[model samples]
Target: MHRDFAFIQTAPDRVFIGWGPFEQSPMRKPGRPAFYIADFFLDDPHPWRHPAEWEELTFDALADRAGDAPAPKIEWERMTLADFQPIFDSARAAMRRGDFNKIVPVQFENGHLVERTDLWPWLFRRLAQLPSGMSAYGYSYQNHGLAGATPEMLFASDGRGYRTMALAGTRPADRASELLRDPKELREHRMVVDDIIRRLAPFGNIEVETIRILELPGIAHLATPIRFEEIGIERMSFVEMVRRLHPTAALGMSPRTEAGERWLREADRGVKRRTHGAPFGLEVADHRALALVAIRNVQWHGDAIRVGAGAGLLPESQLEREFDELREKREQVKALLGLRASVAIEA
Candidate 1:
């Protein structure tokens, strides 16, 4: 099916689906809903789109429509440490040069579909199985698309107030305890939390909740919930809000400056991340939106499939460990997609 669609699970039972023929808009229509689709850099000038049709459906019904179907098999070329080394080295060197306090580098696995098969049903089936606390998101157009459940919500706003979280510092489920006390992980997580607060300082008085562990099937992350309820004199548009907080230290770099942003945009040149870590959100009503970070997703164009995993890097970051983390993330994503079984990490 050559269809264009976008969706996000607003609640455990309520999933909002929007399908195109979408009309691109410079500004969101009053009282109507729209989807804010953008790349990692928010490069799309007109990211707002009014879908042709939309509905809020139960998560169970959404999965039932797809029915029971087997996913297509494909030959996959997994990335090796050697393939990720150059990217990690570059990020680490940049940190040592005082260019950044933290930087995130991504690794990708490429594959080709072996036979003609419909991916939507398989994807929906997998998404329906996602655990609680994770929001499922997907977007597709023509022959290219992406879908997966994200553990991190970029932010959600009801016009006057907002809720977001700083999610970083990954560890295997077996080593979850290590994340609580590891200095390297703590420092990395702190950088993400502090940067988020600093950026939202002008918005209003912010409150940060106690740190907690967000556990998935095989991996876990340090998560800190944040609230931005009090508003200042200036009102920010959904697009502007996305621009301000996107690519937070968790996905981008610390001390987000114009120069640092430009550097990140150009890092690992030629690897255009169309939606990975991008803001993929749905505006449910006037001044209400749920934005999700597009991580842990599988992107496909025709027969070519791409899966990516990124890790935050610090000066003390070791290549071997970083590579292992990347592998762990990719495997977890694969498990989420029903591409493979969860691989447990030895403590």
Candidate 2:
């Protein structure tokens, strides 16, 4: 018999599952490293229970569903540049000030439309469909209702062993088989790899791979895979490392605290209070957990979809090119939404 779980209805559409203690069964099963749970909030004008009540739900009830489930497939749609220029320009200025290196700006094309009944199942199904050799993975945050896929690994540890990546830079990719070999892009990627190596050395004897280029469905990235053996540290304690490395150079420059503050001042203007600021459902064990910078993401607002995208800017980066890149990224979502580019006409 399949395990039956009880979920606390937090909001009309949102349900909260209480997983047992953080220490129990931390590492996911092999080949099942990624996990997710979608909480749907029911539509109600008046609030129900206080937010604190939802935290009591336990995982003893939530179990993996059985059966061969198919992944949720996203249909491709076409979009254009004129629809995503303003946000790109804002990111460009941040880059010039050394506040951030890359900001994944996104936009919404259609309103909030959930094609799946459950988010966790949908996420696993999607992961199973990823082509082999695709090392990085990501998901949508329950609170924010945003989705993202990243090919970057900060670090993975299981007591004695660990692995991480330095991923940066980008190039356009039109086909799955194509490779990227751009020197300028490689240099940008190397900067991140170098930083991670230096910071992580004291904890372990680190090994670095020669920089290589990686391609995604829409872009190419320069990446360096890494491995290490812990010197004397316990496994679970390494969660701190993960926290320290977050919002990596791929997202912004070092001295991240100050940079993040500046970014909030500049880019967050008029932005709604949503889930983009934090990880959706994060848990750490044996020093194992994965999180991604909330970039190239979108949120559902009723029947309207909002997309976000952004670009990296160095002192030498061009504003026009930065703007164009963001526009290009947003087009991906627009195309997926089946909306005409003409709808972006200036009001």
Query: TM-score for all predictions?
Result: 0.94, 0.59
Please give, for residues 1-347, the per-residue lDDT of candidate 1 as tens digits.
Answer: 45688888898878998889998977788877998888787767788888999988987787897676786776777566678787888787777778887888776877778775778888887787789878898878888888878999989884578888999999998989889999999989999899889888876878899999888888999999998865666556677778778888999888786656766777747578778999988885656778999999988988888788898888899999999998888888888888653222222
Best by lDDT: 1
Stretch of 10 with least lDDT, candidate 1: 338-347
Angstrom error at residue 227, model 2: 2.3
Give the distance in Å from residue 193's predicted Cα in candidate 1 to where it truly belongs.
1.0
209 Cα displacement, candidate 2 (Å)? 0.9
TM-score for candidate 2, please give it: 0.59
Which runs of model 1 end up more than 4 angstroms from their true locations? 232-235, 341-347
Give the candidate number with the greatest TM-score: 1
